[model samples]
Target: MPSTNRRCPTVAAPPQPTDPTSRKLLGRLSLPERRFVADALRAETVGGVLLLVAAVAALIWANTPPLAESYQAVRDFHIGPAALGLDLSIQHWAADGLLAIFFFVAGIELKRELVAGDLRDPKAAALPVIAALCGMVAPAGVYALVNVFGSGSMDGWAVPTATDIAFALAVLAVIGTSLPSALRAFLLTLAVVDDLFAIVVIAVFFTSRIDFLAFGGAVAGLVLFWFLLRRGVRGWYVYVPLALVIWGLMYNSGVHATIAGVAMGLMLRCTRGEGEERSPGERIEHLVRPVSAGLAVPLFALFAAGVSLSDESIGQVFTRPETLGVVLGLVVGKTVGIFGGTWLAARFTKAELNDDLAWPDVFAVASLAGIGFTVSLLIGELAFADDPVLTDEVKAAVLIGSLIAAVGACVLLKLRDRKYRALTEAEERDEDLDGIPDIYEEHTPEYHLRMARIHEEKAAEHRRRAEAAAGSRIEGDRPA
Candidate 1:
């Protein structure tokens, strides 16, 4: 079907910009965003460990004799610029101020996932995405059913609809399970999506009133921040003051100030053009994530998790509707939601689970999803701010629910871990004394294809060397 007399049309290539300043700015922006993600992941793992210790210490301090008074006093202490309506208690600062930093880091990660990570591909992200949605819906449904039918308030529905990624991953690391990498990826994507939903719920459902002028001012500040980024302004002095103004404006606007962090993060530029070496989002994440994971999150945990058990007995705590509902919603509802959702997706849709994972592996991971500590605690604080009794009850429930889920995951994942270890050992064994593993050789096509590719690479290298030698000889002959 080739045309004999066809003249190829002349197509012009897009012109490249030649401006030195523009090129320099562009060239300065190229660190791999993947590295930033890896760094953030590590930071979260460490943060999880620190959060655990801080929570335990807070509990001890809140319950022990004289220390309990000191703990209460510290949390109740208030000192800030009262003129600006910022004279908030320590607990308020932790929830509103420090948590914003944590949310900002989360926002950056969400942007990365949406733009270039697994979420960039809908088909590939289907299982986790579907699972996350179902996970949230199912938990909220359970909470609503429990609270609505009982004497509990319906306002706390969103409390159990969160997944603590750091705590869950910390459990995994401690357990030392041999899960497939895909499972970790699925868990992470699901957690990020879960956080995104929680943020939406906080912004929309939780807000009571809005000050339009203040909200508009916050929006304007964000727009100006975006403008500075687009114009290649990288100074912290320029962005920090603007970010604080936005946060304060948002706070005054009656929207949760933490939402400001998510908004600003979403507005950040993530794409890299021809001349840029690194995207603004990646750079900002690198600069800010350490602060979030190391200080902000742990400090929030310290202030938020200090629930005293002196007033109410453990039995009495569990009897409360809010407590029972949160425990059931997290432990039972989360397991059912995530596992059932993923199973249904695989059954109904063309999307399939990773072949490397088994049904039990997914179920174990689903149990891990129930470890809703951080955001669950945050929501509990918000939900029961007026009722100290309910707040204590809810906090106790979150801790208990997280513990049960962690234990279940450890047991299930440990069983799978042994199986994987056995398989790996079998794969490493070469009883026949061949160069390759016996298992690899048993899979003849795969083994042959791998070897053939290696052979082809060697052959190509030889050909290139031969061509270079021939050219070198011809050049020498001509010169002589």
Candidate 2:
């Protein structure tokens, strides 16, 4: 008789969805995290509206003759070690010192992607990776072409590489019904990848002179941070101390302190699912949410969004290749590059087209993806501070590009409304599908109304106009 040993089989846990929803049960967040998440989500859906509101406020303050001084005073308001002992400039602090938090949040998101989000599966991420590469390359190529022989031209290559998440999300929110969630998800993945690429480029290509000793300290701090992370220390307690050290070291390292921001973000991992996408909020991301969303981003917007428009502003932008390239790259190049890249990629890869998205819809989305506000502006200062002319051009380009993307998204979404309306009509006709939830109910008011109502209103309006015309004709024929 032989003695046989059998191992017990472990049952696999329930499979999560391809993209798990984050409206999950969290024990509780700090009061700030709760308010911050609430506001950040609102910002994503309405950042454009917020931008519009802010712009209007600025316009009223800047143009209303009496309030102009207040507007100028606000821009001139300066702070930092200048009042205390350092050469770090105002723009530098806003972009480098403050926006580090944005990078930290972005890094958490990137970690989530690699671990469980869209990039969870190599195959799943392939589509976005390819699309993102194309998206980045095409715009840079287009920008370069636009600046072939122009001044400040060399710096223009990076213009089309950035995708403002706020504006992109705003477009998705406004487009509510026209575009699919899948499309929005796809765009977000591509943008994140693109941002990662841009960050790398900045770290490698855009830094000032290197301070070897300080850089060594920064690198050591990063190594220590990585080790702490690997030890499964997920608390802000560990990260905060190291973040301060790394940031201080990196500032002296001459590698651009913003790189430290990205370093902090990328080095850490976020809680996500396997073979499924997850949100950073699922983990300790709640802890950092307030600092990133509530404090950093709005402040970045407040400081960076301001563009002093003078009589020479328009002229200055056109003359500088850097400005022209950024504007053109973001606006024209973004549309062409995104649409062309997507179309070409789809052709070669034979990727399954998401339902209801035709070339026109694709074009609209591509156009929308070109909006390069926050990151673009941040880079502008980093790339061309010596040349204010170039910065102005970037500012102009960002404003225009973002506007184009937002408006384009709205238009395509309106076009998409027809299909949604039709689908709603079809769904309503089926009596057996009683419990089918209307995910799109929040939008589609016009769709919710019966088709007959639309026709009836149009017909009545036509009849009223026709009768008025007939009466006018009768008067003209009589004696006039």
Tell me the number of clashing residue pairs for each predicted model: 7, 1
lDDT of 2 at 412: 65
Summarize candidate 2's per-residue lDDT along 1-480 as a digit string, tens digits.
111132422221111122232221111222333333444455455545454455446545555678777665765566655432235545456677777877876777677678756577675677667767777777787678767867345765776688876667755665565333445566666777877888887887788699899899999999998897678666767778889889978887778787887877777656544763533344545556565655566556665666656657766665666666776777677777777766666677555454334567667777778888778877777777787756755776677667766776677668656554443343234222334323323135644554447678889999999999999999899964
Best by TM-score: 1
Candidate 1: residue pairs that collide = 26-275, 26-276, 27-275, 29-277, 29-278, 30-277, 30-278
Q: Pick the candidate with the highest lDDT.
A: 1
State the lDDT of candidate 1 residue by residue for 29-142, as single tens digits: 012432344455577788888888888888998888879999999999997888777899999999999999989878877887888776776755677788988888888888
Which residue segments of model 1 deviate by more than 4 Å? 1-38, 275-277, 420-480
Candidate 1 TM-score versus the reference: 0.80
Candidate 2 to native Cα RMSD, angstroms? 15.8
Ten consecutive residues with minimal summed lDDT in candidate 2? 19-28
